[model samples]
Target: MSEEPLEQLDAVDFAVIAFHVDGEWDVDELTLDHLLDAPTLVAAMRRLPGEDSVALVAVDEDWFLVARVVEGRVRMLLSDATAAEDWDLAASVLDLLGLPEPEDDDDQVPAGDLGLLADLGMGAEDLGALIADLDLYPEEILSEVAEEIGFGDDFDDVVGLAPADHA
Candidate 1:
């Protein structure tokens, strides 16, 4: 069957969200209620300062995934790093959301500047789709990254990975 058109996707059901994220940064396994605890996720999506929102997808209570969306795609979002805890709540959320695992072999691969971004993709279209699939709010993190880079411009082209600083 052809993929469902984005427009046709009704508002995501949030009754019992199975939010998920994928990547090394994930902190621990979590439930929908738990992910909701992170107010930043919601605030970023709404583009409101200090405002928070919750995932709208519904899921089985027994298990589900939760995560953050970066650059428009679902990535296993992390709260922070914990050395001893094997149960990563963020990773568990990514799994529930059906997000793919980030390639763990980044260290083995050679990288130049923006190597991490390159892993996301060399083209804007590919990256944009990936970002949209992400569970984490793209605007907030990207804005933060841009500001840190000293660009001080807004990255309007997540599709183009445009260097931005207007955030």
Candidate 2:
């Protein structure tokens, strides 16, 4: 791990809270003082008025996190396991999942449950492949995920991403 503290490395590009209601998806931006804190993020997700809620976060354009709370159970996915070294959110996620902190030379792979969004149409295989694609930025990967889970437009609107051309 680098000598720099997590406070210096943690940079959240955006955080979005999403949930399904009345057959439609509701997406809203979330502002957190400690965006990299897994407990804080999960607690916020759990407080939403829904049976299930999801938080999609992009950090420093280098990694992404998907946290889902279902019936009081929490599931999370971190795009790059190695990010744990530099970000408290990633480290805390590994801690929550009972994963060891990644070593300096560890492969930059994903950690946590890829199936966290399985029931929402983004299965483990699809998510794994998406994160593995190094060509995409964290926000792009999350945008694709939102599309798969039926909230692409809502996510784009909340995050100020230009709408995709439908024509």
Candidate 3:
């Protein structure tokens, strides 16, 4: 949304998305490029807080399984992180803002992962398999998933991961 709709959004609407189910975080673990993608996601993920957190399983370097808990039901927020270039993220935002959906784009979400997969709570292996099916890699998926869920400042070691700026 062009403006923050904190009032319009309920705590349930505020999904605490995690990069992994194992439970970890990184300070400044997010980037601006990723922030641009959240609006659309926020729109589709309207249910809000269940386990108080969700996860993003990276199927590849670019794809992710953004799973969240809502009223005991799970919701998936899958996406091709690369599609932000063409306005998929922004469109999702507009949709959430109650704005009109943009004409046509390459950012359409597929059938299966569009909503929660099952009613029964899954075990670690099941969750892990879901992540594996989504193609999650610990380090890489962790980073990508972190960005997708808005965990920009949870990690303090971010600068250490990048080169120091030279004068």
Candidate 4:
């Protein structure tokens, strides 16, 4: 695959901001100027009003990113580590995690904290399994993730997706 720099937020398929507060989960679309910039995405999540805030981003239908900010600390996960070879967002995510950029020979695997959402409900094993399923698309993987984390309906509503779409 050829490297294609993501120049703007418009290149992203969807960006959703989800938060848990007052024993309820809230979801909204994240509209930012730099959605693919890891630092910018994290900062935006931090500015949201919630005890726990997360940003779910799908880029070009090629990969998905999950960024969760809690008390100013950020944890991130990229669905396909090898996407760094072609995507600036994935490359930035590798930088944020202090990981080396994937080489061409590297396997297309997930990078960063698979356990990022463990406290919320999904464990590392489950997340790894989901990402391992190459038959699923980025959006489908993220949709399952949202469902596992108790924000399925909210996520679908905000992203204008229906469960049947994944079917």
Candidate 5:
């Protein structure tokens, strides 16, 4: 048994939040058992207080995952499918998507629901391009996504990444 929790975002000031429509989002922190399979993820999302919720799971500093629940349909997006080989959350997400485990070290395949944020601001092609850009960190990409989706500053505050509040 590993001492580290299965879902802790390893990067500094970066977190996975369950974004809600009503502005009441929460960090998506789950137990290892809860992340082992999809059913538990569905259960966890169902238990959330939001009418619409999405699991914005961070995959280290390099990538992230966004899983949304709407009308009982779970749509997911892995920021960098390559992270699947390294992160437990990404691998579990591939399981949920019914995709085979990623094996190729050179295969930087970005998989799952690419249109998860189509209605918000970014479409599949747009997100795919962003994920392919190796220069940006997951937090940088997510910050842009948050801004596009209308929660830029709030999200920064949630993750304590807000510019230092010098008084």
Candidate 6:
């Protein structure tokens, strides 16, 4: 199968959510100008006024970033090991995680700490395996991941992804 550059997906496909499961989940449609680096993203998430705030970001069908902040501490995971070289948001994620760009262009590995949310249901390996499933679009995969973590319908609604399509 031929692949389109992930940069193209950033147009309408990139989105981020700052959520507190019991409270609110705010969505942001990411554009090239607002592709904030990790620290900035986390700081914004911090202002969400919840003890259990998490930032979930998906860039097309190629990458996902999950960041959680608790008691002033931050934990995060940036998936799609290969997107760092192709997507600006992914590269910014690498900077936030303090990881270097990939030396090779295979784009098939999990770049940052995958185990970051292992206890929350979707671990690194699970995410890696999900990404390998080329049959699913980013919305479908994100829907599954969100459901695993207890926000299936909310995420789909916020992202405007029809349940019928993913089903």
Candidate 1 achieves a global lDDT of: 0.30
Highest-lDDT candidate: 2
Assess each prediction's global lDDT (C-alpha) against the native: 0.30, 0.83, 0.37, 0.83, 0.65, 0.65
Clashing pairs for model 6 are: 81-111
Q: For residues 55-114, write the lDDT of model 1, one tens digit per residue.
A: 322222111222334344433333222200222333344344454444552222111122
lDDT of 4 by residue, 32-119 (tens): 5547479978878877787699889998887899999987788999988888877777888999999997776368888899999998
The worst-scoring run of ten residues by lDDT in candidate 4 lies at 1-10
Predicted structure 5: lDDT: 0.65
Q: Tens-digit lDDT track for model 6 on 1-167? A: 12343344444364656455455554454443334467767777677665766566776655677777766777876666567776666777778778788887775666666665576677777877776787866667777777776566767777787763432
How far in Å is the alpha carbon of 122 misplaced in model 6? 2.5
Q: Estimate each model's TM-score.
A: 0.22, 0.89, 0.28, 0.89, 0.76, 0.75
Pull out the clashing pairs in model 5. Answer: none
- Candidate 1's error at 123, in angstroms? 11
List, residue by residue over 1-167, the lDDT tens digit for candidate 5: 36443334333234444547566545444544545445666677777776666655454466677777865778888766777666666777787899886677677777788888888777888778778889977777776666666566666666556643321
Task: Flag regions of model 6 displaced more than 4 Å.
Answer: 1-12, 21-34, 164-167
Candidate 5: regions farther than 4 A off: 1-13, 19-39, 163-167
- The model with the greater lDDT, 4 or 5, is 4
The superposed Cα distance between candidate 4 and the true structure at residue 164, in angstroms, equals 4.9
lDDT of 3 at 106: 57
| Candidate 4 lDDT (Cα, 0 to 1) | 0.83
Comparing 1 and 5 on TM-score, the stronger one: 5
Relative to the unseen true structure, what is the Cα RMSD of model 4? 3.4
Clashes of 4: 0
C-alpha RMSD of each candidate structure in angstroms: 16.4, 3.2, 16.9, 3.4, 4.4, 5.3
